[model samples]
Target chain A: MDAAFSEALIALLPNLRRFALSLTRRPDQADDLVQITVERAIAGAGSYDPDQRFEPWLFRIMRNAFIDQTRRRKTAGTQVDIHEMPEALPTDPGPGLEARLMLDSVRVAMAELPEGQREILHLVCVEEMSYAETARVLEIPVGTVMSRLSRARLALSEKLGIE
Target chain B: MQIDDETLMALADGELDPARADELRRLVARDPALQARLHRFEETRRLLAGLRLAPEGEDPLAAMIRGAVTPEAPALPPPANLNRPPWVALAASLAVAVLGLGWWQWSGRAPDGFAPAELAALDGLPSGEVRRLESGEELAMIASFRDGDGALCREYETSGGDLVRVVLACRDDGAWQQRFAAVTKADGGEYRPASGEGSIDEALAAIGAQGPLSLEEEEAVLRK
Candidate 1:
């Protein structure tokens, strides 16, 4: 139990929370996800290789926690009705009323994306991960990451009506 | 040749070789529809970047940390100072709301403004070592040789405020290359050199005090 591990975890909390929220959509669930991730990280601290970067390792844990939660929900026969979930806002609010409208539209469009596409979109595009890193995090092949990202972009362009 | 999605993604991520990229650029120049599609792909990436993380009010990380540290703590406590006047209570509630809003705005939750290029630059370093230096720190060169780690990691901070972290990993080829380097906000919001002498001497001294590097020792961890 190195003291610096706790400090590092604290520094990473904000980004972890954001990533969890994007994955879970619900605040309570996102918090739960983060909690589980922290516990797992703490328990497996010894397994953390010092050579690799910490953020990605932590992020991989967070992603696993999210997937595990989803799997548990599925096993319990609890299906999430995404239609009832609240939406995420625009990154930039821009000006006034127009900005608000744009945000609403963006939120709706984001909500309509499939979970797999949305996850890749958030990780690669929003988080700015390289394809190789994204593949490592998602446990998928690099080609899959490329194709998924391309599909996600195409869908978003259609939904946003971007020429 | 019109680039496929794979090639386009690689190009957009700057993963393509210069010659390949040049060939793609030539193709895009001659193809209107392909160019339009490429533009759309780029715009889509920008729009995704514009998708802000959920606002601060819903931060689960705080709750997660609290829960992990104090699993048996009580969930809620009785209201304190309940005898205050109604107006005071109202003001207090408003104040709490305002403080919450302000915290969300400034809680270091927003992006740290480190661009992908910066991260890429750090990744390009040889030893996988980088550091954040404090401003106005004395130029220092500290080399710590830990028993178990093969080569010594050299760290230093420049007067110009760059903190540099470097590890000389012994490769199979028996050559040492600079591994990791990053430019981050220093103690006074200045650049910290990743290695060398001057202001970074203090850190080097500390590492030197620790011991010499050994074959089994581990290098310092790099944080993004």
Candidate 2:
């Protein structure tokens, strides 16, 4: 691998970890997923198209790795519960305690969403991925991305009582 | 005209065409129910954006991957001047610059301290707004607050190349003085939730900062 590719992969570690956390929910599993994703990315770096954006390509790799891991875990009869207690949520004192609590609720509500909706919401709202990019990442139609993201937002709003 | 949820969501996310977005904006402005729906999308996005993941230290696997990628070197020395708390290093440089010290060779920094573009951002960029420079660097104003001395101060974040820096600058004697800064690796396009602790919290505590100013309050301060 070239220097640029290695550097980019290293820089994207935090993003990979966050996405993995969203997928696996457990921090330990999230770390393992990130490791697996980086290993796969490096192994397949030669196939990555230089002209395309790096993020969607990397994210696709992560999601695929997650699916593979889930299948293996299912066969072993050791599936991790999706509702595993969350680690202590981050508290941002800068935004004040009230806003911080509201954000905590947002995280809790997000966890309750359907897996498809949760992933799309994280991609669009938190990661700020464009609809086209999100579609590429999720392997879905752009229309599906829009409708899913819209539904996710509405679900979140209703959960939070934001009329 | 009835607007679909997808269209309203797209408008809220800034994914719609400019002309169509403008049209919807006008229509939504006239309808209270539409405004509420728009607010739902907007507020959800805002709250979600606030769900910034705190950075745990780099995993050991990263080192393993680094080793695999590098053919010649087993390990590279960590980037220089970053092992220590960045604000401590930045504070020294800021002190030097403030005392009319000789020019120091900090990359992307103006000789007088603030980059011309950064000064422009400090002057007017509202909290939560982001500006992209011609050089592909992105500047985001995080918030504004009053320091212990009641000076108006702003906290902003800048990312370019592979590094993101969060800085606090205060208005002093008709100029913005660089106060505190912390650096971290850029995680592609992820929304960086300013971590609660570490150097930023230390800076805030040392400065006796009250809290972030509201939009109206920040605007009032900027107007002066």
TM-score of each prediction: 0.53, 0.58
How big is the positional error of residue A30 in model 1, measured in Å on the Cα after superposition? Answer: 1.3
lDDT of 1 by residue, A1-163 (tens): 3556656777777677767867877667777777667656765666898887777788899998788788767766654543465443224335478756765666567668888987888887777877888888889998899898889888988999998
* Candidate 2, pairs of clashing residues: none
Complex DockQ per candidate: 0.15, 0.23
Off by over 4 Å in 1: A75-100, B53-224
Query: For residues B1-224, what per-residue lDDT tens digits would candidate 1 score against the true structure?
Result: 43687677667667779998898878888889878878777877776665654444534444434333312323543212122212222222211111111211332222323223333323333222333333332333322233233433433222332322222222223323333222322221111223322222243353342433222232332221
Report how far residue B65 has shifted in candidate 1, in Å. 4.6
| lDDT (Cα, tens digit) per residue for candidate 2, span B1-224 | 77899999999999989998998999998999999999999999988988755556675555545554534432543211111222222222211112111222324465448777888989988887889866678888877888999998887777666556667788988799887776554222222423222566678778888857777788788888
Give residue B11's lDDT in candidate 1 (0 to 100): 71
For model 1 the local lDDT of residue A43 reads 52
The whole-model lDDT of each prediction reads 0.54, 0.73
